[model samples]
Target chain A: MTKIAKTSPESVRTVACIGAGVIGGGWVAHFLGRGYQVVAWDPAPDAEQKLRSLVDSAWPALERLGLAEGASKDNLTVAPTLAEAVAGADFVQESAPERLDLKADLLAEIDAALPEGVVVGSSTSGYSMSEMQVKAADPSRLVVGHPFNPPYLVPLVEVVGGEKSEQWAVDWASEFYRLAGKSVITMDQELPGFIGNRIQEAAWREALHMVAEGEATVAQIDQAMTDGPGLRWAFHGPCTTFHLAGGEGGMAHMLDHFGPSLKAPWTRLEAPELTTELRDRMVEQTDEVVDGRSTAELIAQRDRRMIAIMRALEEVEREEAAERGEGQA
Target chain B: MTKIAKTSPESVRTVACIGAGVIGGGWVAHFLGRGYQVVAWDPAPDAEQKLRSLVDSAWPALERLGLAEGASKDNLTVAPTLAEAVAGADFVQESAPERLDLKADLLAEIDAALPEGVVVGSSTSGYSMSEMQVKAADPSRLVVGHPFNPPYLVPLVEVVGGEKSEQWAVDWASEFYRLAGKSVITMDQELPGFIGNRIQEAAWREALHMVAEGEATVAQIDQAMTDGPGLRWAFHGPCTTFHLAGGEGGMAHMLDHFGPSLKAPWTRLEAPELTTELRDRMVEQTDEVVDGRSTAELIAQRDRRMIAIMRALEEVEREEAAERGEGQA
Candidate 1:
């Protein structure tokens, strides 16, 4: 295993996970994999069993990536209440239902129980950090640490600060997430969907428009992205990929080549108000594409492929390092 | 290797590639890999050597994918001129410069040289197919068959038809590309960047705006995508991923959770017009993130990762097939 930077066993001894849903379960797996004892709370019956099952299924890929650390399943504990989950915890991750009222109420409860200086992070997809931290005792200690689903595999965690959020809190959260093997991006200010969701929404908006307009089927549009820009964007980002599209001259050439078309009214900025017909179409199309695959099977397949990609990247990095050494010699 | 649907070799025995640049060379490699004789033309003095080197480097990967079809290097021939390249060709793929006038002249030349019933496809990124085919001998035969870079690896090919293009021509072209191990998406009309580039451009526009607004650095923004949605998106499209984002309810739940945020003016529809300052910042930031990785190295890394991912998907498919068979028994 590559030595994780700036992390120590003592730095994050106990982590609290509030809400043991799909996202929360993923967080638990990630924290446990990184050698932290996880304390989780969820009012739902069978939450523990569900989370355990997810963690068990996720372990092999995590182990392959050196993500599983010095802990076993026995190290994870289920807290009967929120306070119990957070007591003596170094960090708390909240993945409650997305209602602001529910989140605010939970924050108040959690704030009263949290030890001073402990960082509280939210797994919010669209809620503002300012709103979520309104009821916190020390709002400065609360930060929005929005992670992509299946956090054990996906590396992104968008770290944002509320109006009262302290710089140290953001830095500490960022550092902690990095220690947990996540790629952290600190936002200047909290925005809807942070960065990833907004981009996703824009693309979705256009795709929905195409489908609505009868220009293409859901399958065709999906294939175009997966087989084309999605593949490129997976490795090189949209900006860099476009810069390459411009050929040797880079973005300048690209802009010159395709700039005029940017003004075209083809982009349906108006969000497709999801009519029942559209919704049914989407569900039907998705079913067709993913037929015969259960959610568990799809997730497992996704995890394995993610592991393979990460391993390939590691191999590339190793080769580059060797080449650099040879050049130096 | 999965059993590929056989395409009769007689239908596309000889492929004529005009302008043996990067894209054209990719076509040459793809066709030759699929057991088609490829005749190519380029004005550059060393075009033949360059194409040869590209094909040689690409061959091993093609062989691994069962795409090389046991063809020799000599299967790809460089003709002295456009006329010579198109002579006796079954299908002609024009990858000449993106300039409209250049394409106009080249298409006319190709149309005049190729025998009757030969399908002519353009590798134009966004030029209208109707406009490009305006001067062709039989404009109905012209179609846009744009493939993403490293075409042999990436499966997406956008097939758009000219105003005069026949349904049979489009279907034939689609089948031919699929036979060469590509996934085809048909476009109703030729719009700028077609489906993939336009969607990508939307994301890039926002990324640039964020950078210009000082919301995040280029590296941070790039990391956000690579570590976040980019990872999941490799397995599923944006819409599908977002549908999963809604948790159990799918797109409806996702929309309800995030739909309100669509009205927020977070993304700059007009990205500060990509000023010189922004351009320099973009280039510098991209360099930092890429850290001196050569284009060839990046391409190889991309190819390696893609192959690994496809193999993993294949495994999942096989397992599912086995399970279905067992259930039936």
Candidate 2:
């Protein structure tokens, strides 16, 4: 393994984003909005123009979100070569296409070009860092820093290390993302699709089944979500929401009451048997999630946030309607 | 069959709510907040007190959302008997326990007492209305009007007809829900778990698998959603969100690009066969969702709404923190 370069998360000022497509361009916008100097590289002939336009379009949203001090769109540069992009970079984020061969080769190239100790984060939504790190000589510094769509707006960045990755590298990337105003979920081990994608994929597949069987329309599925569970999920997750559904009884009561229904054909996916051990763990973990807050308190907090979210959505709809009216006039 | 109730959706002055637990009590709160007199009945002795307290707790959130004209908690009454509750009632909503026998019996009882032509809606989350209406004499009037938790706040109320239900009843329930300031999704046919719960259940089951296998914690799962897809789902559903992820090409390009990964073991759930028919349907339906708007316009709308949502969340957090600090003092 090659000797790694030394750098601290706080000392990083320059970010090199390889593969300036949607996700890569998003990272450019996110970093730039945070007042960082962003250097991007992509092999596509018109990549520069597309990247610049993406940044320009995302600027107003970032401005409304309150850009970091000294943040500006002009702080971006599209490099002609990958090596030149990472030559003076303090950190690297690679968002190449999902083809494993292409990702491995590009990761290896980035590893060879990036400075000795600077951590390299791959924005692979599904691939584990272990799979991508296989071709790199210094895989110790590589970690998966998967982000959701429109990384500039969404705050989640799931971080995890490969088998060969150093725990410190994973920790550093997590801390760096947190410092950059992103909510980070750091995993101890690699899991297929990680946490978010696995849950999302399950729901997505079920939706596909509905459409395939002609059981529901795509518009109905979308409407069902935005109007129902999606409203609660804006501030709460499925687990906590269920806990609240149990009323004062909490998750334990919820499991006991609804455990039998798990066998019901709610979705195409069969649930794991609610064994004693699984039941205990879920009940325990959910209690830990409750974290000393009473069910009533949690419900109150949820209501407050949900009410605020609805108001915000209403305001947005009003603004859009007003803008449309103005355009029509 | 007993002659049906004769009240129209417009003349629904008083709503009879049977089985006053969480969902039933929520219906009570919802109707009361919409300026309707609500008479509630439950077998449990303490249900009246519990229902009142729930309404009291939910009132503040409803107030924040702006109560309808003349809406008040004083509009509610705790009826001693099921017959008393539905006497002269213009509409009946049954929120009994999820037991099929109990629901069928309750529906029959409500049907026997309700005025002619008045529609009776069951708040059954999973059981199809067909099964519940099996024992009712006037099954044509029974429809499912399932609402999410805390019915007073969340706007979604899914309306669907049973095999025996009249299309007019389904349409009336849907219209009534809309008139009450609730978002309504009317379904043409019965499907197990309806739409929202199926999608939610699929995700929930996947989450249970993770916790069952020790792959992730409950907190991590919740965090993954709240920080990731949950933000987007507040305004956009999974399909539209995927459509946006396709960049300029929209859902068609997305299906072509990521369709292969459907076979990946992202979740234990098996995806449906992505035949050409399904593909064309999804593409066409998603295009319908998009209507005449360009991908760029949709992205900009998504960004504006997301930014507003984030700001709303931040503000709520600050208020909660301040309250906690005040409590400490």
Candidate 3:
């Protein structure tokens, strides 16, 4: 049987973040902003300096979102090694590169080093927890805690257990993520790409198809989303948006009305090949849009816009709750 | 050669709206709110009352968005016949049901009734203008002005001419839609579903697959979006988003890094069969999430949320422009 963490999810104080790149650094920023001590380690030669730089860049956005009590950049530590990082942590988050062998070796190393019953959550966007846990000693405690990019700002964290994972560990990770101020969706089974990625990948593939076929330019595709469905998606998901579109009939009417059209060859079902021509076209078009702006500048722009949208959503939810004569949701 | 409208698109005054269901009524409301006299017609007996009700319901949202000068719901008139509706209009928008034969016949009727060169925009979600313009007398003047649901709120309008459609007509319709306060995307070719729907239909198909396979509930899929990519999408579209996700590397790096994973079977490529059982499950699950809220209530809620997000995006754009020492974008 797998052991459970002794510390309750709400009481977790120190978190170990392994392999601090973009996702890991974002996690460091998030944990530090939430008033927890974060110990981070990465194998890159200048990882400590780069991680600090990433955190420093993310600090202003976190401040705008309102930091937790006692949250400070000083609370973060650059551990000398992976073992040192996980030795005293109540929880561990591994954000290594997406290579399967590297991820498995890292998880096993962390498993061997961590105290018994400590939960380990991996920030893998693709691989299933089951695939990564095969090499770990305490595979039962490892869970997938997939998050969107810039995890410090995006609120969603999908929590799911592997085939060897214990339900208690899954529940523990889910609770811990929620307690860390995240909107979490816990899934029972291991599905490839999970929920968000599956839907998003489909959309992305469609965009690629359009660009490949010259049906629309990159700017036009992006504009189509931001101006149209993307706005609705900010508040409502695809299903609910369609439900509202049905007017008086709701989902039943929506399915009955548009279901047959689903068979129409509107969307290119197969993924487009990333041929050299396609790749060059995409890169060139994207460069045109980026248009001399540095990635750092784009990141800053993206973070600001995300914060504004999130605040707007929060306000909407609060108003709706108030209208319902209830407290904040 | 087809004659061009005597009145420039910038000077279009009275507008004709054919078919007064959800899409048509939304158009009526949008035109009226934009301070244009609106003539509407639908063959159904209760068309006038329903159209009026829909316009009335959408009015609050338009008011919140700041209606144009002299905008008034009282300016809308429901004509007794289709000919009357199109007789004196400078522009016509046909929002009939999605049957190709019905649409072609209706466009032909509208073409015969209207002035020689007034551009006609079809709000058909599925059929392209090429198919709908087949029987029309002035096919050159017919174009697709596909708007997302609730055209009064969502700013995206995709404009494209049919195979026989003149470039001049497409340009005029695109410019006119932009003038009417929409973010317009002018497509050179008519791909199935145009820009927004193609991308959106891809995402929606993935959702249906998840529900049909029992991988996720309706609520979970929706939550994944609202809390994740949907938020990012409010400001940046999918292509730019992945570019941002590439960190210091930008899109060139992103395509190189994650482009290979496009082949991963993360998304179910094929659309699910909409069997009776799947339909029942979808309706039942949606009902559970909706929790007995009337469609009108849902629409009101959706509108409030969309307005809030759009305003938030506008604020971000304004701040960015100010930072750049430029006028508002």
Candidate 4:
């Protein structure tokens, strides 16, 4: 069972993004900003226009982050069909709707048309890659390259493989993602919701319980983070933060001190019954916070803020890297 | 019962910070930056020197964040004793050690020395204010003003009252904290960790379970957040983020779609057994990530990066305020 080694991501100049909705279109914009000639396709009739608009909306942020040489909107081409989109592509990302059947069919179709060793990554947030790879002829090269929202701005990409996936494919995808300016987490085992979503879901569940019990408002919960732990998380992970909390003793001391409180009723692990009352309260609270802006407006504000944060981190990161004399590439 | 109406926080010109550890020292620096005359005292022999050095290290970041018209290091006075620290102070912030007995005795001591109607706020991260207020002669004026690490940079200070604490005291403390440049959450009722610490503890417990079970490394777990959901958290909290995930339907659709997964085996609500094996693994992994940097070095890096993130958020916040003519005052 010999394996086909993958190409160096730096050597791959053209990329393909299939099913260009919000997630796919974000990938298209991100790739284009990195100077990759992007071939995009979606079955929807208005897909081309929507994708182009998203690219345009995202460009200013990319420019602020500093675009790669030769990067432009002109570099993105909308193909009429999937085969044409992946015909000569070096990498393909499938971001179809979350229907498991739809994703299985879409991934298999991309696999059939693509050349060997050209990895096909999925943008599905929660689906297991093994389930999506079942219908593919060459499932060995399929990998999950899950990203957070506004993929063009956020640098994280969770890279993992299916049961049928080859180790080399996962390795290649992780390396490619890093070269593409993403913070890559390569997971050794498959877990429901992966790593990031799982941690997020736990916190989300607890937050809902808080709202259901009428302990806090949606606004207060948001403030608790953006003004508190979230600031620490920007530079360090939760583990690191807690380790810092341990003072000089590190995680060991922290666990011994705060370990008993973990079992206290600080959190409700069970799902809170989201009754109609809770639902309306959530909607109304969010509406009050939104204060007459559309979802698009909220998203645009988020993007603008996200860009500022990334640039701030980059300012220090670039300096630290220069001092170390290590080329980022 | 009739309430004693609190005075306006803008009238506060002097602040007393007792027991000057990191959190206490941070309060001193933050108050000084807001242009208040700061009087601080600590029992440790080197406390004055350590406190002064901390304020000096943080001064540059606070300067970048912009200081009040009269803000200066020259305004700080390290008192010879706790009684002197609170003498003639317009407000008091107590940041003694986390021990309940020590805090109870200390709060009572401060209460006896404080003038009528002046509020005294504690900096305990997890203890209930009521527990700490038990021994105080004037418990009505005691409130919890829990803050995250490096309080000079992070703006959140969870303010809440104990069973004996007066409403006016909590209100006065909250408003005073806001005027002092802290984002204040005045909780209605006392819970174990207040809102921010409760939410953070839930995530921390789940993360520890992952590490204990050998499902993920300490570094990988941290990576999962800093790269993924942590990005969204900087702008929005968990509830708002899940609402965004629901597409146009908001939290209702999100609850309906992903609510069932809340009960899945994704989290270990009970504390994981922190046996020596688990403890050693955590320590070693953290050391590797620290990469020979002393804890002091790690903390310095965190402080520098934290200042960068806060400044980034402030840039947009200031802009949005100007557009709305709020003046950020």
TM-score of each: 0.77, 0.97, 0.83, 0.79
lDDT (Cα, tens digit) per residue for candidate 4, span B1-329: 22453346788888999988878988888888889999999999999999998798668666766799999998999999888888778889999988899999999989887777788899997589989999988799899999987787777999999999998889999989998888899999887777887778777766655655556666777778876778567645676565555545545555556555555566654233333443333334333333465433432343344446656766877887887899873
Q: B97-205 in candidate 1: lDDT tens per residue?
A: 8888889888888888777777788998758788788787777778899988766666788998888787667777877887766788877776766787666666765
lDDT value for candidate 3? Answer: 0.81
- Report the Cα lDDT for residue A307, model 4: 46
**All models, RMSD in angstroms:** 15.2, 1.9, 14.3, 14.6
Q: After superposition, how far is residue A129 of candidate 4 from its true place, in Å?
A: 1.8
Model 4 residue pairs with clashes: none
What's the distance in Å from true for residue A166, model 2?
Answer: 1.5
Q: Candidate 4 versus the native: TM-score?
A: 0.79
RMSD of 2: 1.9
Candidates 2 and 4 compared: the better one by TM-score is 2
Q: Tell me the spans in candidate 3 whose CA falls farther than 4 Å from its real position.
A: A270-329, B270-329
DockQ top scorer: 2
Off by over 4 Å in 2: A1-5, A326-329, B1-5, B326-329
Give all candidates' CA lDDT scores.
0.69, 0.90, 0.81, 0.76
Candidate 3 lDDT by residue in tens digits, B12-107: 999999999989998999999999999999999999998998888778667766699999999999999999999999999999988999999999
Model 2: which docking level applies? high
Could you give candidate 3's per-residue lDDT for residues A121-170 as a string of tens digits?
99998799999999988899999999987788778999999999999899
DockQ of model 4, rounded to 2 decimals: 0.24
Ranked candidates, highest lDDT first: 2, 3, 4, 1
**Ranking 2 against 4 by lDDT, winner:** 2
DockQ of 2: 0.86
User: Lowest-lDDT window of 10 residues in candidate 4 chain A?
Assistant: A278-287
Determine which window of 10 residues in candidate 3 chain B has minimal summed lDDT: B278-287
